[model samples]
Target: MEKRNDPQLRLGEEFFNQPCLSLAKAFLGKVLVRRYADGTELRGRIVETEAYLGGEDRASHSAGGKRTERNTAMFMKPGTIYVFPIYGILLCMNVSSEGEGAAVLLRSLEPLRGQTLMRELRAARRKEGAPQLKDKDLSNGPAKLCQALNILRCFDRRDLASDPDMWMEREPDTNPAEPHDIVSAPRVGVESHGEWAEKPWRFYLRGNPCVSVVNKDAERQSGSVTDNVRSLTCAV
Candidate 1:
């Protein structure tokens, strides 16, 4: 693949209008850009994501067609931002996809720019005595990435395609990842969702150190797991 010099190619609704599972996989290698009010910019390469199917997906917040103020963004048009809180203080970000109530969770990102600002933002959220975060740990998890990027709950329902403060972009200069370079696995947490807990909805760049939690078994069975996800998509 030939590299282009353009860096302003933001991902639009069309790019995000794919099915949740496809969007999750496609997000890998894309660039996530966040701009601060102070005119600072933070960019990270999306390294990990998890797909949540629509109402039929038991593990999803919108399961059983339930809708609430918190998850309303999931029902919005593709490219809408869904920011929600976890553990009371931490926030996680997701992007609504083509499904009725489906979305893709950004699990982790590899810092690509503004590392100094990312470190400062992350450290400000931690206790004063906590040890400094390593470079790879800067955005290695959902909440961690949100913190490092300063993503707030107020960003919920915002349009990613038009949001000036935060949006996803594609780097023309970077080669797109091959299928073998990505891995599929079961999502983290939500173990009580019965069979849903075992469904392979999570995806990440294979061997990327920025990934939050790597399931070695899932990596070993990635081919079969990918097939399973494909079958599930067909069944739906």
Candidate 2:
């Protein structure tokens, strides 16, 4: 087994030297550890991810050199966490990396440890008769996964390196997902991107309840739908 890395690991600069989405694809099944404000650690295994290469990639937030305050993290160093809101509802997290300016959006994860705590985070909603999270639903979507892991907008642009508060760990291979079972689809939203919108670039874990529902929650009236669920995608 790879030795347990220091919980307060400051990854060497070399970790940044890799193809962004390829690394993102390799992230599947890896565990992310969060030492919450309450001093309790929460853990989740990555089960879904979406790659967003900057600049030339039309569907990317930093495409066409259009830099917005929200997308500034794309230009940051590799391994940086880029957390953002979607439709003012869900929180999607991204790991900033790739060439000089690029990023890979982490679309979903399967909650592992501290699940009781995750369910607690949703207590208010459950009390209000909102959808109760089955063990699988806790971290299904980006924002939902954040909630399950107790990650807040405060984590936006937070340096995953040097921050003992949170870091991803290589844990035991719990339930290894397969590449064949994985699926890819164009990202949701940004129809204005034209051809980029038609590009199949999204990936998620097969049959993972934690994987986000593509064009789900119909009552909300959103983007085109797809059954494209998978565990990983590399924007190669």
Best by lDDT: 1
Q: Name model 1 segments beyond 4 Å from true.
A: 1-8, 223-236
Q: List the residue pairs that clash in candidate 1.
A: none
Q: Which pairs of residues have clashing backbones in candidate 2?
A: 91-143, 204-230, 204-231, 205-230, 205-231
Candidate 1 lDDT over 1-236, as tens digits, reads 12222336888879999999999999999999888766678899999999999899999999998999899999999999999999898999999999999999999999988898899999998899899888899999999999999898889999998887888888877887878689888999989999999998999999999999988888878767677888998999
Q: Give me the candidate number with maximum TM-score.
A: 1
> What's the lDDT for all of these models?
0.91, 0.69
lDDT comparing candidate 1 with the true structure: 0.91
Report the lDDT tens digits of candidate 2 across residue range 1-236: 12334644334335644677666666677777778555677778787777777788888878877778897777888888888887786677888876755787776778777888889886744557666568888777677777777777878778766566777765543444455545566676667889888666666655566777653333122122222222222322
